[model samples]
Target: MTPSYGVRERTAPAYGARWSRERVETAALRVLRWLTVAFFLVVTLVPFYYMVLLSFRSIQALLLAPGRLWPSLGELTASTYVDVLRSMDEGGQGFLLFMRNSAVLAVLTVIATLLVSIPGAYAVSRLRFSGRRQVHFLFLAVYLFPSIVLAIPLFVLLSLLGLRGSIYPLVVVYISQTVPVSIYMLRNYFETVPRSVEEAAAVDGASRLGVVWRVSIPLAMPAITATALYVFMIAWNEFLFALLFLTEDPANWTVSLGLARLSGSIEIPATVLMAGSVILTLPIVVLFFLAERMLTEGLTSGAEKG
Candidate 1:
């Protein structure tokens, strides 16, 4: 039998209305999610793309066509990058030296921060010590302390010790800045390691440190990797401390300091400044991409089946 054009649902009117409401909500949420994603993508990529485009062309072309969003092949010039990356002796900005210094400082900070924070975190998590429960608060307190406060004392100390212009002193400062937060993050991951596993390792004649190195570290590798990446980026992009320490010594300048100089120098064209910015940005970008897999990996994935 054919149904009437207008039919009322008698079995469950409330369920029909509720179901319609839920479907509408779900569809609306899905559209909102895509719109949000597209918005962020545009906000992030457009400025970076424009900066990159400007770097590939001459300042003359850019000024002549101020509103041009894209450039023709003939208008594009690689000289901006050449000047940015070349040595000062060759009448260029010498960013390669700056990049090298930054790389050294960042790598050293990562290593030293990991070394100090791992044991500190493990002890806070596992050992019975006075104020162990409250240790995290201290870490947070240290992290919350203003950088300027720390920088003043550190700068004075380094200068007194005749350590100015050396990257090692900067490395030490970065280590202090990073280690507290690293310990804070690593502590939680360390606590998640089963005491039984550690006990078994101890029963097998492993020392406390050995168990940490052999068993706990493997389990918490994902967290360790993430913390390292975090610290690396902090050291890589840190400007205030780098500027305070290395500003007087151009040879010891980091990418951040070099970029700052480019920005402040009127003789340096905006295109050249953009090139310096891209150079400063590339290492962190590459590192993030390389560690993206490790960052997303679960700490306890292999320990249990979900």
Candidate 2:
């Protein structure tokens, strides 16, 4: 009987033998990962979907069915977009002007920041000048200061220079804010470029500038594009500076400033506010999608190798 019991015990498999501890853990983690992804996707997309839905909905329909997630086709219209985009003189919110101002500031900031940062980053990376290591520390220190600390001084300086309420001064401020970060980013990318490539070009009678332009610039285009997009978004959405400088003149308002004004006012409709939000957000979304590959490469640059 004891021998028979021993035989029965040996013949029966151990409990949970097929599903080992590691296997159970792995399965749990896989399910948890998918659940986390789905939660975040819902969190991110639902608001934006509601926003787009509200933007298309009429005020009457919105008030009638405030909780409705889906608006009827008949209730949807582009009038909200029209209202947001049309000029104040045309009895609308005048986002078109705001868009233009934001565009100008963002474009100029991108250009100026890139122009300065590229050379600065290259010098910091490739050259052996005195205080070379300290330069990056200075850039980091400048960026670490709260932007609010710079705002009042900038406002006063712009006043003295008679540049307040002008997009040009806003561009200058953005350039100051963006250049250090741009240089930091570009420097990382530039450092990744092999010296052999530059030396080859230089040996072939190309100047130092030619070697950089022909070799480094092309190689760093992904990073440059990412930096430009970063600067553009900063300039486009900046509120404190825009408020400090441009609040006196509605004509000079960037989209962010205008949207802020709208949000603060009781008279503006929620639908219109949603429309303005879409207007402010849509360009960045479109631009990001268009350059998704380049941006991914740029962000991941040097992450593994460096």
Candidate 3:
């Protein structure tokens, strides 16, 4: 039989075209992924590196060499840290008080948020009630609203109540702002837990509260830890609420507000402010890394089954 060129030629060209296209797409995607990684690494690290470098150099050195990336050994000093951390009466910026205030507020907020959210989340996930759907909607609404908008009304209310500048009111605000999201996070994890386990505990003569205390809480410990860390970071890094509430009272200033105030003064050196920024950022970085694994597990614990 004579060789048929039509079928063989057409089929060969189509196969070749598909193979070439796939190879081209694969190579392009590989290159793009590396580029994206490099871009993010540079974006995230360069500013932090610059901040540390500037923090160690003298104001005079930075003024002399504004574009320099590295400071000479002779130009490096730790006085900026000392100056930023000491009390105002001691001829420094008084960041020690700022750190204390920030810590107290963050801790209190975390505690209060967890206290309210754990039970609230448990109820939402496990109970049947008339307003259950409405409650979920309300939480979603609050979470979607801009905090600044709510801050205005809260500021007015606090002022009327004579609690405007107090850290106590800020704690209340943080709890209200964070609790909705906290409940949402915890509720999802609660739903993932098997109800039979709770039933088994009940069969063993466990009271409702006892079952929740021993069974639900223990099962959701990872999510709770993650939630607490999240709440702490939010409260620690809060600037808008802190400024709105505490700006008039210098003694109540958190680290975020303190660093901002420092930047507004002509007398304060940039290097000293950079040092303050570093101090403010370090605790958050440490806490995040410490809880990172638990947070990851908590968030992904139920994903496979879902």
Top TM-score hit: 3
- Backbone clashes counted, model 1: 0
Name the candidate, 2 or 3, with the larger lDDT value.
3
Residues 148-253, candidate 2: write the lDDT tens digits.
9998888888899888877887887888888887887788888888999899999999998998899989998878888898778777878888999988789999
For model 3, how does the per-residue alpha-carbon lDDT over 1-306 read when each residue is reduced to its tens digit?
212224332223558888677557767777798899999999999999999999998899999999999668998999999999999999999999999999999999999999999999999999899999999999989988898899889989988888877798899999988998788779888998899999999999999999999999999998898899989998999899998999878889999999997799999999999999999999998999999987666557658678
| Poorest 10 consecutive residues by lDDT, candidate 3 | 1-10
In order, the Cα lDDT scores of the candidates are: 0.85, 0.85, 0.90
For each candidate, give its TM-score against the true structure. Answer: 0.85, 0.89, 0.90
The clash number for model 2 is 0
Model 1 over residues 142-161: C-alpha lDDT tens digits?
99999999888888988888
Error of 2 at 46 (Å): 0.9
The true-versus-predicted C-alpha distance at residue 293 of model 3, in Å, is 3.8
Q: Find the 10 residues in a row with the least total lDDT in model 2.
A: 1-10
Better of 1 and 2 by TM-score: 2
Regions of candidate 2 where Cα sits further than 4 Å from its true position: 1-19, 300-306
lDDT of 2 at 20: 61
